[model samples]
Target: MTTKATTDDTAVRTSVRVDAAPEHAFEVFTAGMDRWWTRAHHVQKGELKEIGVEPRAGGRLWEENDAGDVCTWGRVLTWDPPRTFAFSWLIGPNWQIPAEDAAGSRVTVTFTPTDTGTLVELVHDGFEVHGPGWEGVRGGVGSDGGWPAGLRQFAAAL
Candidate 1:
């Protein structure tokens, strides 16, 4: 079963269960990021070679391509091992970064132990600050190719 709740108007939330220990799940989600995160969702100029979450507070979540160009998606906000991970995701309007101003949203992922394995909860919020074009960004995230596909890939990797 999947449950989605929207809080504060534009925020989106989703949860999925994975058949793995919380430690393993978190490791795969963060460390093994490149193995699951879809390439189509990124905003980069060159072909992507690697994508990863830099596992610490204030660290960068980045995607690097074959041309040695790096595009940073956000900064890690919270990094609690095997439990919670949060970051600011800034892809800007229509997946394009602003030349002068960058507006970002927040995504938080939590891992909970369960009888079967682990429960992964994701929350993407803070859209109001993205300004007028926020609706487009919000819609994309709730679309088929967004969290649903991303979580499916993540679960499959486990």
Candidate 2:
């Protein structure tokens, strides 16, 4: 996995590999984000109803709950088929404030085809503004209780 903080210094990036084709891996990752993502660890808890990715640049990355409330988690910044996808990552009060009229941090996921399978590189930038508090959020999402387990689930679904 590859990880780095933004130039401003408040976010983190993490990448990992999956045993699947690039296109398939990308589909599994985005279409099945909710399935593998740990429900218990979600910021909204049991209230999280659905996680949706619109599959295009400027598409919405959002969640809804049983209460009929919809919250935008992010927006697609770049969408290159079978190779790369970039979006905003905003959750919780801390990450909600826009850095420059833009909501949350930027997360880019790149898929590279390898002889064995696809290598998924996730880049989550923008966090230095939040300072120490961002660490907890980053750490939480990195642990087994977060994205790792979620990505594993995504891979298993394929």
Candidate 3:
């Protein structure tokens, strides 16, 4: 969750075209998140029941497990429907919320209508906060098994 120096390599951005309208794309990304997001991405130790982003500004992005335990990953920063969405990603290296703002990051997703469907773009920034520990987190999120993989799953679900 560390913020990195504002550089191209520091910000993890990915875009995918989905076979749905902008509104439907937004719904699947937010309201229907649990159906697409993978349990393997959870930092929890039990079976995951759901992972959701509350559909409003300031709402929490959280995960609930079969054991009834909940963990919050971030908070919604903006809630523009069928277009743009942004949130604070506060989880840190130890899989816990950062104690200070400098240790957290931001994630913004945009949905734009195209000839075929909607183009969903995700940008994960602010990794400089981790100071020396930034690279590992960036690699994890940008790797084949990270956000790209998750988005692929999301598109397939749609």
**lDDT string, candidate 2, 62-152, tens digits:** 7776777766667899999788988877653353423334445567788899887887777666643345577665665555545555555
In model 3, pairs of residues that clash are: 2-127, 2-130, 3-126, 3-127, 3-128, 3-129, 4-127, 4-128
Query: In model 3, where do residues sit more than 4 Å from their true spots?
Result: 1-8, 96-102
Q: Write the per-residue lDDT of candidate 1 for residues 68-88, one digit (tens) a residue.
A: 888788889999989999988
Clashing pairs in 2: 9-128, 10-127, 10-128, 11-127
**Window of ten residues with lowest summed lDDT in model 1:** 1-10
**Candidate 2 off by > 4 Å:** 1-13, 92-102, 129-132
* Candidate number with greatest TM-score: 1
Model 1: C-alpha RMSD to truth? 2.2
The TM-score that candidate 2 achieves is: 0.77
TM-scores for every predicted model: 0.90, 0.77, 0.88
For model 1, what is the C-alpha lDDT against the true structure? 0.82
Global lDDT of each model?
0.82, 0.66, 0.79
On a 0 to 100 scale, what is the lDDT of residue 71 in model 3? Answer: 78
lDDT of 2 at 32: 70
- Rate residue 61 of model 1 by lDDT: 88
Q: Which model, 1 or 3, shows the larger TM-score?
A: 1
